[model samples]
Target: MKFDVVIGNPPYNKGMDLDFVDLGYKISNKYTVMITPAKWQTTADDYSGCASKNINYKQFREMYVPHMSYVCFYPQSMEVFDIYQIDGNYREY
Candidate 1:
């Protein structure tokens, strides 16, 4: 089946967040809205040791970034989820 939009708050473990965005777009006809760590944007090329190891973030960026319409970032310290804390070393998104 196909969809007009795909929205999700995918798990953050093992780079599943990136997977959701990748697959979400494939199944959606219009948009894929996902809540993923903002860190991915800057550390795109650094997931060589994780589950996203096979993903070429450089090429991913080149393909999908231009189509993005909006993005919002909240500091990891802000505890947006109030479930866990992410390292605040990289604060700018």
Candidate 2:
């Protein structure tokens, strides 16, 4: 059975990563949209800065997880941003 509406208070725990979830949402529904933590959607080369040089929203949206419908969370502080942004690069390995 398919429901017409769905709802929930999705978690944003420290250990939780929203990238996989965001991609799932996009692939699950062509009309779906969400305001996720800015970092997960777009960040610098080392996963730093306001806007990333490598990572992008399009990449996040490309993840394939059909069960994920929506997301709710807040961005990490600028201090955390500092950790990711080193020497003008986002170094996520």
TM-score of model 2 vs. true structure? 0.28
Those runs of model 2 whose alpha carbons end farther than 4 Å from true positions after fitting are 1-9, 14-17, 48-58, 61-93
lDDT of 2 at 29: 29
Error of 2 at 86 (Å): 22
CA shift at 48, candidate 1, in angstroms?
A: 1.4
**Angstrom error at residue 43, model 2:** 2.6
lDDT of 1 by residue, 20-76 (tens): 788888899998898887656776574564466445566567777887999887765
Residue pairs with backbone atoms closer than 3 Å in model 2 (clashes): 43-52, 44-52, 45-90, 46-89, 46-90, 46-91, 47-90
Cα lDDT, model 1, residue 20: 76
Candidate 2 per-residue C-alpha lDDT over 18-93 given as tens digits, one digit per residue, 9 for 90 to 100:
5334433435424444333444444433432223333344454454324345554544435443435344344554
For model 2, the run of ten residues with the poorest summed lDDT: 6-15
| lDDT scores in order | 0.70, 0.39
Model 2, global lDDT: 0.39
lDDT of 2 at 41: 45
Find the number of clashing residue pairs for candidate 2.
7
Q: After superposition, how far is residue 29 of candidate 2 from its true place, in Å?
A: 3.7
